[model samples]
Target chain A: MLLEMLQSLPQVLIDGLALGAVYAVVALGYTMVYGILQLINFAHGEIFMTGAFIGTTFFILLMGMGWVSSVPQIFVLILVLIVTACLTGLLGMGIERVAYRPLRNAPRLIPLITAIGISFILQDVIRFIAELSSGNYIVTGPSLFTDQMTISFSSLSSIFNDASFKTSFLIVLVTAFILMISLDYFINRTKWGTAMRAVALDRETASLMSINVNKTISITFFIGSALGGATGVLFAVQYGTIDPFIGFILGMKAFIAAVLGGIGNIRGAMLGGILLGLLEMFASANLTLLTGGIFGAEYKDVFAFSILILVLIFKPEGLLGKPTAEKV
Target chain B: MPILEVNNIETYYGGIQALKGISVYVNKGEIVTLIGSNGAGKSTTLKSISGLAKVKTGSILFKGKETMNKPVHETCLLGMAHVPEGRKIFSTLTVKENLLMGAFSVNNKQLIEERMEIVFGHFPILKKRLEQKGGTMSGGEQQMLAIGRALMMEPELLMLDEPSMGLAPIIVEQIFDIIKKLNQNGITILLVEQNAYQALNIAHRGYVIRNGEIVLSGKGSELIENIEIRDAYLA
Candidate 1:
């Protein structure tokens, strides 16, 4: 069993990296919101689900109009991703203004509960919309690529079969990485990003410095939710199907990834997300063999959540977060 | 016209009143000090003028225009800068970044660069630690950075709350010296300080506030020598 696991390590690593990339992108939404507001933004999962539905709906609409058949697949995918991101970004800002802004000075529990309530509201809204439009709970995304739409590793053809890798996975991984890098640069390099950091550090001071606190918070929601939207589009393409309820489990996992990486730390979210993905993949792949058939892929979520519980119990600050001393 | 005028301004925090019918003014290029003990509303007066605190019954006129209803950032953009009670500099931001944030309302890159040079001249230590984190510095350095940051805005009126709050006596003296220099440079100043003697010594005029009401107002030297002020505050 150990030798078999060793032989499959390379394949596991590739699969894990791709899956990890998706989680990292989604986890950023949670981390960025928490960093600024110290609120969990439980509704973020719904935003991701909304993005997927929106992307899927747009693709279906394009197909219905015969545009998908004529347009290049990449162009169609790019269009859907951009539209989905912008819509979700606006949705996120609306959530902030309507639900969270009024309760800014309320006790911490009030906003947190509001976030959870917003999450449910978003989920139900999407479900209602989906049912109204499709007459079904599940939404199937259009397949933009043919079976032949794959990149063959010609140089490694002799060692590993050319048919093994999917170009779609490569595209998702590269796109996620590029988005994450640009986000890092924006947060560190731009004036608006500096204003964001200032507001996160101290809102009143940031305002006193002539930085518009409301605008900064709004922009933060926009960027964070936009990333979630982009990730949602990628998830729909990779899975070929989405539902209003899909965000629940995936969002929980992304939340877990944020906590694992350090909830308020950006780089930590990325690290935690990739690590959680790799763990899920490896455990699911090797569980039966390692546990001598006692456990199987069906236990993947159980394994993943157990890590969250363990991490929370032992090192709640997470792998990269420092223990911050709260000023009285 | 006075650079700033506060007329019968009343402010509240929740149901409790913090500033009750307080009125004050600072003429152009004058150093006006508001001296009070803890919770006497010295900070509240500055906050009211800067639009950080809501005024229920008073009008704040800046450059002879009513500004009581303006938001904090709008007031800041209109050339009023408030260095808050605590050195509330963004701790994670580098020194240069904090100063740059001070100039957020100023869009001209050339003006920002010129102001940066002027700020460096005021607090030369800041130039040496431009890349250092704001929070890691000593109290005196942070105070300098705070003052330096406020100066970056090129405000017609600069309001400071407790600039010497936690600094050593020597650093406090240096900060007061810089405040005087800033006043001499043709900037109007509204200084609130618990260190009454030092505040009045540098002020052209001063108001003695106690329990949200002004008890005395006079030229700086006269108030410094007033028996009531000397007994109640200077001591």
Candidate 2:
């Protein structure tokens, strides 16, 4: 049984890392927005979903225009990522301006509820647009990098089965890492990033330092939503089929990853995302063996949520979260 | 002409008026202090000038620019830096980062470093602990950090709200000395304080505010000697 588990480990880890990469980038959006606003932006998931739909639509349009054949697929992916990021960034900013800004001083619950309302609106709007344009809500774009690849290490393949993955996995992983590293640098090293930290700490004081608080918040929304959207594009490329509902489940998972890592800390979100992904994959691969066949891979979400409950019970602040004092 | 001129400004919080027709002015190279007890709109007046507190009516002129209703950040661009009540230090940030935040309006790194040198001159302890977190420092050090942060802007008019609040007497003296030295170096100061005696001692001119109105204005020394002033504040 142990040998059997080991046989599957290589595949699980590879798949886990790719999924974790997706979760980590999406979780960043959740963590960053939560850190600054102290409001859980439920619309974020829909933003991710919207990105997937937009990316697939763009791919179809590009192919229709015969642009895909002329340019490198990687450049097309990059273009889609940029365009989708900007569109979703603007969407996130508009949500903040139209929905959250007026209710800034309102009770905290109002914004949370509004976020949910916005997500519902986005989901329905995407569904409506998809139905109108394509006569179906499910979208699958032209395969760019679906070539299968094998990994062989003479020393390692002897102990474990050789891992195999699609080229799209590499694309997703590379794009996510680049985005993550850039975001980390932007948050910690850049003036605007440090300024965001200041605004998170104290908005009034940040403004006194000549940092425009409203603009900073708007930028935060922009960056967060942009990352989510780009990750969504990467997600579509990795897994062929997508729908408006995909963001909801994937977003929930990423959010869980954020919580697991420590919601407000940037690096924590990354760690949490990758960790959650690997854990989910591990559970899915071995749940039957671990549970004497009582539970199977289908119960992966149950396993994932159980960990969240356990984490909440044992370490409420999460793996890297600083225990903030209770505030009224 | 005075570097800063506040003409009968009215400011409100919620539905209540905090400053009602309060006027104050600071000439170039003078230490001007606003002394008042708690809830006397001292902070609000400074807030009004710095664009932190909304002024419902009246005009604030900073270096000949009418800036009563400008954005808080634009006020900083107008060469006005306000160190708000309670030191308002970004305690989680390092002292260097805190000072860097002060230089937010200035883009040139060399100019920022030059301004930082001036700040270091004012507070050597700050330069020594450049990497230390602002909150981990003592109250006096945090206050110094706050002032040093504001000085990064190299403002023409520096407004401080309660710099002396919640500090040991000796630390308070050190802060007041810095204020005086800053004034001597041609930075006009607008000081708001609950510690009327200390404020008056270093002030070239003083305004005594009561219930959001400036009830008395005179030379600091003269106000310090007035009988009614002594009875209401000094005593």
Best by TM-score: 2
Per residue, candidate 2 scores C-alpha lDDT tens digits across B1-235 of 9888889899999999998898888898888989878888888888888888889999988888899888898889878889989988886778998999999978999999998998999999999999987878888998999999999988888889999888899999999999999988988888999898889999999999888898888999998897667555643
Colliding pairs, model 1: none
Cα error of candidate 1 at position A32, Å: 1.5
Worst 10 residues of 1 chain B by lDDT: B226-235
Give TM per candidate: 0.95, 0.96
Off by over 4 Å in 2: A325-328
lDDT of 1 by residue, B1-235 (tens): 8999999989999999998899998999999999988888999898888888889998889998888968788888888889998888888899999998999877898999999999988999999999998888998999999999999989999999999998899999999999999999999999999998999999999999988999899999999889898655543
Which consecutive 10 residues in model 1 chain A have the weakest lDDT in total?
A154-163
**TM-score, candidate number 1:** 0.95
Q: Which runs of model 1 end up more than 4 angstroms from their true locations?
A: A146-163, A326-328
- Per-prediction DockQ: 0.66, 0.55
Interface RMSD of each: 1.9, 3.1
* lDDT by residue for model 1 (A269-298), tens: 999989888888878888888888999988
Please tell me how candidate 2 rates in CAPRI terms: medium
What is the lDDT for B181 in model 1?
97
